[model samples]
Target: MKSNRRQFIKISTLGTGGLALGLSSMNLNGINAAYAANKNEAVSDEDLTPYPTYCEVCFWKCAAWTYVDKKGEIRKIIGNKEDPHCNGRLCPRGTGGIGMYHDEDRLKNPLIRETKEDGTQYYRDASWEEALDLIADKMGKIKKEHGPECVALFSHGTGGKLMGHLLKAYGSSNISAPSFAQCRGPREVAFTATFGEDVQSPERTDIRDTKCLVLIGSHIGENMHNGQIQEMSDAIDNGATI
Candidate 1:
């Protein structure tokens, strides 16, 4: 009985060891296969022309280089080392920004909503000129009915600045940027109530120099604030406590 028990234990141990070895071998082979496949698809720098650009995926606006092939196809986006936002690393969204151009399901044209005789609504593609003309006609009718000041424009970004100018010239003082409200509205209000001034975007938090970081409800790493995440990493390296 004792000899049988010893044999059983040895066999079990050997079987487990063998299974682990087999799995490791399989994993190594899989990794080699992936490496070979990637090597075959590798593009040389000479084949790509890099253009300086900033990611529009999120508000971080991480500067990056858009590498295009000889055929003007956007191949990849690499973070610009000099950029203060990301340094030399782009977030997953920014890295995958090229996928936006390649996605077949992306909206490529303006669509106008039309109703069927039975009252079901569907959208039909329309030319850019037709869309612009329709918008202008609607705006004209609205201006005729109500004063231009009644036409409120909720907008954001650089294009929004141009639209704000157009609305201002049209005599509307009701232009508001929704981004400011969405991103920092509550924080702005709180800061104003407490400190008399709110911290602006591209906030100047000296995270790297801080010894202790207290996050009340902030999701710094998960929020994809590239600069803040990088600085937080440095702070952690320098013995900062969160």
Candidate 2:
């Protein structure tokens, strides 16, 4: 309880990763033996607390339950049965999202760049107030030097919506998200040009009911498209030709 940050981080990282390593090294019989030996040490499913959440591993954001033991340690992640996107089964990435939580290298604090006497640059952890003040100061200077229109924003995910609004209110209309460059923008343009309609999120493809599932260069099952992959499987089971 009195451990320093480094000690706490080390203990947490090892504690989280130990299970993964143990399972990975064990075969079926070894796993069974290990489980039998530690049966009493294992937390019962009913005892573990379940928290409803959404997977942040990919854009699909499948709904899930994060199970935590009495000690507040993450036990596992499982898809919510009622979630339409997952249909009770999460993708591999979604199931493994706990790795992000226990990742040792993830940034947990703000850092500011500092230059040493040797002209070497390094990052030093800064307080939230310091970081915010520095950002405000820099933004003020930028606004004074160049018009706000010159400050273009590149964002992703739900947070991008708020960032876009902030940038626009700052007199900049140059807000862009990854969808514009990655796939959505081009796909929308092509679809509108050909079908005279724009494709929307939770796309209207209806892969599960389609007679023909065409793939030019797309890999629905191979990627993190959880819902689409499930639909593709359904289509194949129903005699749809790929």
Candidate 3:
């Protein structure tokens, strides 16, 4: 009876070892097949042009791939599939960046107003050095004569933020932005009053894991962020009502 029990134990151990070896061999065979297939597949240099980078066109700061041509010129931009923020999608503005870069109407150099008439202005080309000198002289004369308070500046967007910094550096207190007048100002004012914080871009909203989303006065359909738009579409596809 003891011999039979020992024999059973040995048989069980051998079966387990055989199974383990079979599974390992199967896994190795699968891996080799995949490697062989991949080795035979030809990948063109143009197809491999996309390289990882980051987008700064908006506050999203989405990770992206910049596709370059043979001449090393950027031909296209696409969101990185590895990015948690954009998740391999871009908005219309981000996609249109290529067009903007190649736009014929884009300003290549500094221009100065040569003549000003009733609601009309004519501009002429000027060197950056000459333009800066003229602007400095005029601003100095204005400050000396009418005081610094006489100059007021109105700006918009991230570019406006830079202008705000410039205005502060120039020692001007009369500076404002139209962000309040254009969009979500009342909501921002109320939220700030209640929470003691002002709303800002790239706000901390994890839309990916959210089951339900509520958009009040904000128009998700029109005034949409690329990430938000993609999230909304995914939510609908997953049978979550908007």
Model 1 TM-score (2 dp): 0.72
**Which candidate would rank higher by TM-score, 2 or 3?**
2
Clashes in model 3: which pairs?
none
Task: Kindly list the per-residue Cα lDDT of model 1 for residues 1-242, writing each as its tens digit.
Answer: 12233443454456546644754554455434434433445588898899999988777898999888776667678899998888889876677566555544447999899999999999999999999899889888888898788899998775788998889888898989777877678788887887788876567678989888888768676566878877877776677777
Report, for every candidate in turn, its global Cα lDDT versus the true structure.
0.74, 0.74, 0.64
Q: Which candidate leads in TM-score?
A: 2
Residue 80's lDDT within candidate 2 is 92
Ranking by lDDT: 1, 2, 3
Please, what are the lDDT tens digits per residue for candidate 2 over residues 53-172? 999767888899988878776777899989888888987667766655655444788999999999999999999999989988898789889989889999987788898888878889
Where does candidate 3 stray beyond 4 Å?
1-63, 116-121, 180-201, 206-212
- The all-Cα superposition gives candidate 3 an RMSD in Å to the true structure of 20.6
lDDT, candidate 3, 74-166, per-residue tens: 566788877766778766546544554554445788899875666677888899999999999998898889887788889765577787777
| Candidate 2 C-alpha RMSD relative to the actual structure | 12.1
Q: Could you tell me which 10 consecutive residues in candidate 2 have the lowest summed lDDT?
A: 1-10
- Cα error, residue 106 of model 3, in Å, equals 0.9
